[model samples]
Target chain A: MIIKRTKSHIAEIFCNVLCVFVITVVSVNAQKLNDDFFSPKSRLSFGNYLFLEKDYLRASNEYKEFLKTDNNDTVRFKLSESFLRIGRYEEAANNFKSLFFSTSLTDEARLGLFKSLFFEKNFVRFRQYRLEENYTTEKFSHDIDRLNYISYFFDSEPLPDSSRLFSAFADLNRADIKKFYYMKKNPDTKNPVTAALLSAAIPGLGKIYTGEIGDGITSLITTGLLVFLSANNFRHDHNFRGWLFAGFAALAYGGNIYGSAASAQIYNAGVKFNFDNEVKLFFEKHNYFLPEFDFVNR
Target chain B: MKKLFYKYFLLIEIFVVSSLFPQDRLSIQFDYANKLFQTSQYFDAITEYKRLLFFDEAKKYSYKAYFQIGKCYKAGAKFDEAIKYFSTASINAANENEKLSVYFEIVRTNISRRTTSRALQILDEIEKENTNTFIRDSINYWRGWTYIFADDWKNAADAFSKIKSDHELKKLCEQVEKEKVSVTFTKAISYFLPGAGEVYSGNILSGSITFGWNLLFGYLTINSFAEERIFDGMVIGSLGWLRFYRGNIQSAEESAKQKNIAIANKILKYLQYEYKGAKP
Candidate 1:
């Protein structure tokens, strides 16, 4: 009977020890979760640090953790924004989609989604979303029209001439005219291989088509001079020198032909690139002339 | 016993969650790599970055590593290698900006190597693949430099003018175009006037050498004939005086050629090492 009583006493001691361990563990975890969610100022500070450092992925994660606890729409919006900053467009779109259903951030969410889709070049979905979502009315109507105009760049149809379709763009007062023309005309440039072949057939022709008249002329003249020199040297009975000059002439002639055509192709590609960037920037600045999601707590 | 179970579970949960959360290891590595890059220890920094890629937590750093490697090669003037690495980086980069940066490096490196045609080719590729206005403008600005290096001053001027801004590059290209002398014209001028090109090239010493030789030979030929020793005069005048006169003409031509080469080299050297402007 005395041994049984001693065993029971030891069991009680063990239970108490176990209880303390559990409580300590629980408190520590609870503290961490609480710290992650409840401390807005700290979380914001950390998020900002990551953002400034361009650690967008990490910033998004931190903001996500903050949002889990805080559940503040502003914080959620910012978390999605971090994803956008990192070019995690799909994730950003999904996050924005979540906010779209219920929150004062619905308009901002829709706009952010549109931007992400537009950047991802998902025209079909972007168009669908544009038609469905209601953008808040504001005084920057001209800016909105510009954004709408640039968005059409991602559309499937050919762009109309700025002089005809976008004469109004002239009055819009943006320094992106070159950018627009570059985008509009880029797709129409002849094929690179074909241009290269054309140039190969006749020096500088490719460059001329690409609007590099000076380069074309120089290439033709240089190649022609080399050819003349080589032929003259051969006629003078300097066979060794003639052959050497001929070889050099041939190389230069061939290379220039190749280069000219290649240049034309490159010029077109550059135009296309500039167009996209200009359009994206227009949207990034919210058309620069348009009002963005500037809801004053209405 | 139940309380003990809950407590242990909580501790385990906390430990598990903490472990699940990604840490600053990637960040720390990027910071170190950036620091190494800034210090110009590019090769060693590259190794550190490749280690990060091995971990492969995020594929983004891999692109950064490749881009830096290209840059390191470019810095060392190994442009062919740099272009290869840049192409590799562009192929694998996660985003448009990263890819564009890689393409930019390819153009820049090629231009630095005096492979203007290749740089222009890559620039076209960039233009086709990219859709950013700022990037396009920046690329065009560099394209102007490519034309300049290829000795197509007029095209360079046109490219810069098309930028439609107070872009310093446009003004610089215009300056280059205006200041440029036609190579053929310069060569022909030297052929016409023995020392004119030397004068144009600001080589008084060479000009004087040419002038002195021509004058001395002229006097020698004239005086030798006046002496009335027909055979002696013919031989001396034709072989000695005439030869020296011809040699002076050749020397003048040579000096002008050298001067032209020097000018071209000066422009190339500035572009290669000193000009604080877009290159490719």
Candidate 2:
């Protein structure tokens, strides 16, 4: 009977332990759920989730809400990133500027600011800001220099020599840069007056000079044939026919002269169009030579 | 003491089991997913809904989760993914009502993908199943939208005609059809008589200029040949007369196509922005 009573006593101890265990486990889970749902950092946590999903607008709002009570570098970087994703480069630049001083995120924010400026396509300001005394990250100077050089291609800045270009850029893209440089320096410009004079002196010669071989051949053959016909008609006593052929020949000659000048203008336009396309494609494919930042990474 | 201890342990076990069992654990996740969806985070919403389905032990929200995922994909313009998830929902549907909703979503996604035939086939399936008048009308509405997206205004009109005799879209389609010029006719006319096609298509200045040049060059070539000027005849006939004639015909064909595009664009733009109807 005593042993039975002892067993009962131990069972009571076990039951109380089990009861406490259940209550504590349930309360802990409940508390965690409540905290996750209604805590101060819930919006921040949700914002990070949204950022990972790349929902910039909503994520930015959440970050802004969290920033009302806190001032942290990571959230600031993300807020700027959210602006950058939606093409609000001015806001992105302004936001990025906040994290650009003496923080672990200084390099990232500096890069972000420059990227915003680059994408804003305001080349003048981008160049000017990069030269600003404290606005650059030392580690990313080469990247900034490459972007600065690329900007000159689209703007009025005369391209610098190959020696002055970034060494990293030289290894991969020096040839293209030099080609663009030469095109800028010694453009294949055709003078309209010279082309017209060439066509007048020798029928269709100006079209050949402008690289329109087929048109030049056709014009030369037609003008030559018409002139020959006019001369032959006059020799055969068909005077009226001879005068009409002469008039037609003169018209053809004048039209060819005008067409030659137009062709040169078109050739120059083609040159400009091709150059513009090449520059745009190169910069776009290279992402303006900026480093890929994993800001949205979880 | 043993009896009380046993009673207390039994109560604790019952309390833990009953409370946790009645928690409706997936409800919180469902609400969160819905919140994500409402905020326009479509891609994120898809993940949340998918996660809800993954964690839902009882499969209570499986159908709803899959359907919401499909809706999210459709919003993001990911039509193929949308259709896949919608099909999964249809397969897992507990009743005909669930299946009908899934089918409707499938048709909508197919229309946005510009797959008119696939959308029509689903509509046919819905018809064969003999749904209610409301569903039938909805099918016709989306089918009409599918036709419009496919650029087949005549068929779009025909589709909308099933809903009512004088449906708004049908009337618009009729107007566009009447106003649009026939591209084949323009091409054939230009082949027979250069510049006539352009004139018919309302390009008076271009047609006049084309005809004038053709006439002038034709006269020159014929007169040269009659005067036994073979070289001049050959050069002007091949270079001046043939080039202008071919160019006129080509330009006439192009103008007809352009006019057709312009007429279609007028309707498309209205459908895109101004029309207050259901759109894809």
Candidate 3:
């Protein structure tokens, strides 16, 4: 009878222990579910959604959260891509560089790094990094080469020989590229010194050369009228009036010379602006000849 | 033995059921996001709301999440983003009242953005769609607010008068209209008599100075011609008399405009800081 009581007591104890165990396990699981709102998995999914929506700032925040407890190549790449889209070049370059040594995305990462440098206008560093074959990939070498050539046009750097530069682009784009190259080499820009010299020889002539015909004519008329007034006053023995008119003439003539030089500078700036716009449009149409990442669609 | 078996089964069943009901989990997330919003952590709240939207597969929180997102953006003064999300919320609204609420939110956002024309257009559309007296009155109220934002005090008064003859906003608008100077009248008066507009706009000192200059230049020009100094007369008339005369008219118009702007700004400041009313 005592042994039977002992078995029953043990059974009761077992039930109580099992009840506590079940409650504890369920409570822990419920707590986890509550915290799942900001879990890494949730962050990654939200980050991907934001990235697809082109909300790069928020996407980068989410990706940063996800990366805290996990290591993911695609997520890292996407994080870097987000920085690039938002014009955060330094962060993007650093993130892309982290994947340079070993990964399925090594080439893509290298390319992304180069793009970050290029967009930041860090052309010198971009060229320096491009020379390291370990940092570049055979698959995208031609793309990097094209970017390098494009960088030359953006700055005062001398272009490579025509044969070397043209070979980097496709046959269809070569003609336009060659045109831009020549335009860069010998830009149709007016010389400011020459413009000043022209204005000195004939009042407002420099302005006319720099494409301000109305202003040039106005300047010429004002200076000529002031000089004529000065000469006529002097002829009439009105010495004070003559000196006043002569002083005004000298001021007008000096101002025209200065204005002509400034006009020439403005004209050169406009030519450069147009040329840069054309080059930018041409490359934008070509997508900068960069390879598309299929993963972005997924 | 059967009783013990039943107890274990119950424990396992509880676990399974708790895991299966993700709605409870979603409710917790919504509360978490709401807590963040209440604390004014708007940027973080937006991310949490977006997460809720992304995970809400049954779309049960679609309207609420989108509406909250709109509110968050509106709080940040991001009117364009607020309007975009409010539009999305309107699409997801489950009932007529819900849809109307979202539409009103968009109109309010547009009002705050100073897109008064669009706000008025939306209010017109809402009035046409709803014939209920309360809704119509609400539309007129918003229309009044829209006109107020546009600095059209007369139209604002007219809109508020539609709601009630003795509406507070209507009285305020009428008072503002009375206090405001007419730019066109000021310019016209200045054309006939130099600096009259500036005086009318309450710049007595500046108006007197401008008038004095005009009188002096006019006298010099006439005296030059009288003295048979044709060159002096021509120069004084073209450069001195004409310049001051034209300047007095411009200054008068500018003074009227500036006085009206000051009047509008006072009312706007009152509404923003002192007046106790529902604001956009």
Candidate 4:
């Protein structure tokens, strides 16, 4: 009877020990699991996965969280790159600028900052930043120079000396770059005032000169028809009809002259548009002459 | 005896702890992302969901994560992105029910985007595969909604009637059909009599002016011809009478189309803003 009582006492102690073990293990494991899920290393792992997937927005979020605890230069560069990829140029520039003085990524970051400024279309600021001796990088100076030369194509600024501009690009790209340079310098554009004078001399001549052959023919036929109708009405002694037709003919003549001038302006705009597209296509094909980053590709 | 007791105690402790906690890292992550979604922080929610996906190496939460991401895009009115993610979710669906749910989401998105033919095609495909009455009914219901979004009230009414003889949506569709002007009738009436189509389309003032001008031109053309002034008759007939005649038909067709658009827009606005039912 005493032995049975001892066994019962042991059973009670065992159950109590199991209960305490379960409570302590569960609480500790839960807390550790939660912490580990969002720990710095875990965030870096997830951020790298997202970055490789090209999901930059989420990757940037993860990288930002990771940066709060770790000061890794590659992570900072990638964070800036993520911003650049997503078109947040201001944020990207700021992030890249933060890596300027004390990181192995100084040159790449400077180039990234220049790229951000260029993409923002802040040409003046981009040029000013490029000219800053302290901000310039020997490693990517040629790349920055190529980007600076490319910027001139986007605006109405006069093209730089052809030799200097061509020298910034590789020999393979020089022909296309030279073509863009010449197109920018001397765009084959018609003068609106000249077009107006031509149309005033002979109806629709200016429209023909502006590459609107169909519109020129229609204009000529319409004005000629109205003038013929006026002369015909006057010959038939219908004075009121003749005067009405003459009024219409005069309006058509003035409208044709105005339309010719507008057509010439449109033609010039088209020429500029085509030139811009070609230049853009060339730069895009060459990746704006920017050096490829092996780390990013990997 | 002590070693066996310790082993049993450890097993009991493990079972109790696992059952009590239930949630692992992935599940906790899912909850965190869901909380972001519940708060209507869609963009952030998408990022969190993506984070879950990136770390969910077992792919246990892939279907839910993708489906939720699709929902986030839909809420943002990014329909193309929504469709793309929904397609991914459908590909990852583990069960027939999950597949059906993703299909419905895709159909609903297509309807919202006004891709009516694609929505109807998906509904048709669902109908062909499933013989279950409840699933068939759901297919018909979505088919009806697709027609309504396409502005084809007649087909909408037909589809809803297949679900129930006296369905409320069927009745609404019928009412919309009644309210809309018939473009064909408007064009036909204008062919018979100039400007009569516009009168039928409820533009009484414009119709009256059109009729008066056409009659005046007709009279002038006939009078000039009767007076043997052929040139005058030709000029007036070609430029005045013919121009007005063609214009009257075109204007009538345009008025009818405009009236139908306004009717459809009114009902659609009600459905969008006031109607308290599940919608595509």
TM-score of chain A of each: 0.57, 0.68, 0.90, 0.91
lDDT of 2: 0.84
Which candidate number maximizes TM-score? 3
For each of the candidates, what fraction of the native contacts does it recover?
A: 0.00, 0.28, 0.38, 0.28
lDDT of 4 at A69: 94
Candidate 3 runs further than 4 Å off? A1-22, A237-240, B1-23
| C-alpha positional error of residue A23 in candidate 4 after TM-score superposition, expressed in Å | 5.2
* Model 1 RMSD in angstroms: 20.5
CA deviation > 4 Å runs, candidate 4: A1-28, B1-20, B228-232
Regions of model 1 farther than 4 Å from truth: A1-298, B1-23, B57-60, B128-132, B180-183, B222-280
Candidate number that wins on DockQ, 3 or 4 = 3
lDDT of every model, 2 decimals:
0.68, 0.84, 0.91, 0.90
Worst 10 residues of 2 chain B by lDDT: B17-26
**Candidate 1 DockQ category?**
incorrect
Tens-digit lDDT track of model 3 for B154-223: 9999999999999998999999999999999999999988989999999999999999999999999999
Which residue pairs in candidate 3 have backbone atoms (N, alpha carbon, C) closer than 3 angstroms, thus clashing? none
- Residue A176, model 3: lDDT of 89
Q: How much is the lDDT of residue B277 in candidate 3? A: 75
Error of 4 at A197 (Å): 1.6
Error of 1 at A10 (Å): 23
| lDDT winner | 3
User: B1-280 in candidate 2: lDDT tens per residue?
Assistant: 7578779878877877765665545677687889999999887677667556655668889899999999998999989989988998988899988999899889888888989899989988898887688878888888888887777889889988999989999999888888888878987888788788899888989988998999999999999999998978998999899999999889998898888889989999998899998777
